[model samples]
Target: MLATTRNTLIQLAEIQHQLQTIHEFFNKWQTNPWGFKEEYLSEKVLVRFLKYETESFANREWEAHRKEIDLHIILQGSERIYLEDATKLTEGIYHEKEDYYLLEGPSNHFITLSSAIDQENSLFLWPTEAHKTGVNVTDEAVMVKKMVFKIKY
Candidate 1:
């Protein structure tokens, strides 16, 4: 997460530099069975493997950890992420087993993201942003590369 605009700019530049390295790594490992792994600028920046199954979606209840700036990079397949407006969120019965609270459905705002491999390297999500992920309509599974950073207010 970026603490300020300046930090966001810095992170963006560093991410751009790392994108070149990531592309090379992807070229080699895109078809590899072992997959790939790497560390970014610092421990605060991370690269990890992500897979989303077809017709599967994750309903999540998230609260701010300070503030968050997420860089979701798709490395393989495709999935739709449903985001709910924070202002519209209302408390629901806690399901301790799931480790997250459920929000009343019939959301007022949402967005769909398709395959974005050749277009851009990163997408940003802010704090208090309620999001439901892994909505895939395709038969093929989707792989994504994500870097989650904490933004200090």
Candidate 2:
């Protein structure tokens, strides 16, 4: 789960270089939808495609991916993402393969993420960060545009 400002993402040339690979993959399924898949680009990074239906709320326990940074980009719809500091993560078991740990306790604080009004870019998430993404309680289908790229620290 990656979340951050657009400017921050553009500054990372390594990430910018990989955008083409992501775009190529996104172009294949823009008309359709699917779930997460690992697209290996090289030893330094891997692109992950994720699709989730928009709903009132989505609470998830993520497997920890230590030392890797996540780049999240929205490709279709709009939704809010909540992120909390991993140090405050007091719950959830570690699933090494998935690369994120679930949080059982109440989150202390969170950063909110929504669609970019100006451009399409990726949001970066540090390793061990705990986060949640979805729409608020409402009766509508929210199309979420996103891409998660794993980067080695």
Candidate 3:
């Protein structure tokens, strides 16, 4: 898993290049809803712009993908994301269409992200990493808008 910001992007050309199309996509959808056509980034990449109320960490499940990497960028609010080694978790059957596997048990650690930090605050999870997102940082549930870029691996 990789946690970074826009400030560090210039130094990560190899990774940033994979996300180049998102910059224009963000600009074009500033006022648009979360929905978009499947595979917006390219033939294999799927971009999901989602907005939802933050939930308790206990309510979220740890999920890992087999063929895609998860790129999470917080655009509107704050949330804590928990990550764990997929190999350590009890895995459920993989969902081919969604490209993710359901994992049981807690995570090894977590990180928090918010829009105030920077528009580029992002987290990338590889196929071996399981993560639980949408957990609130504070006591109250806040609405969070985040973009999930599913890049084919």
Q: Which candidate number has the best TM-score?
A: 3
Please say which candidate is ahead in TM-score: 1 or 2.
2
Q: Better model by lDDT, 1 or 2?
A: 2
Indicate whether candidate 1 or candidate 3 has the larger lDDT. 3
The digit string of per-residue lDDT tens for model 2 on 52-130 reads: 7666544444334576777777776766555667677575666666566666445444443456576434456667676
Name the TM-score of candidate 3: 0.79
Q: Write the per-residue lDDT of candidate 3 for residues 75-99, one digit (tens) a residue.
A: 7888888889999899999999878
Specify the poorest-scoring 10-residue window by lDDT in model 1. 59-68
Model 2: runs farther than 4 Å from truth? 1-37, 62-64, 108-116, 119-121, 137-141
Report the Cα lDDT for candidate 1. Answer: 0.50
Q: What is the C-alpha lDDT of each candidate?
A: 0.50, 0.62, 0.79
Q: Model 1 segments beyond 4 Å from truth?
A: 1-40, 56-66, 91-104, 116-122, 138-153
What is the TM-score of each predicted model, taking all chains together?
A: 0.51, 0.63, 0.79
What lDDT is obtained when candidate 2 is compared to the true structure?
0.62
Write down the RMSD of candidate 2 (Cα, Å): 5.6
Candidate 3, pairs of clashing residues: none
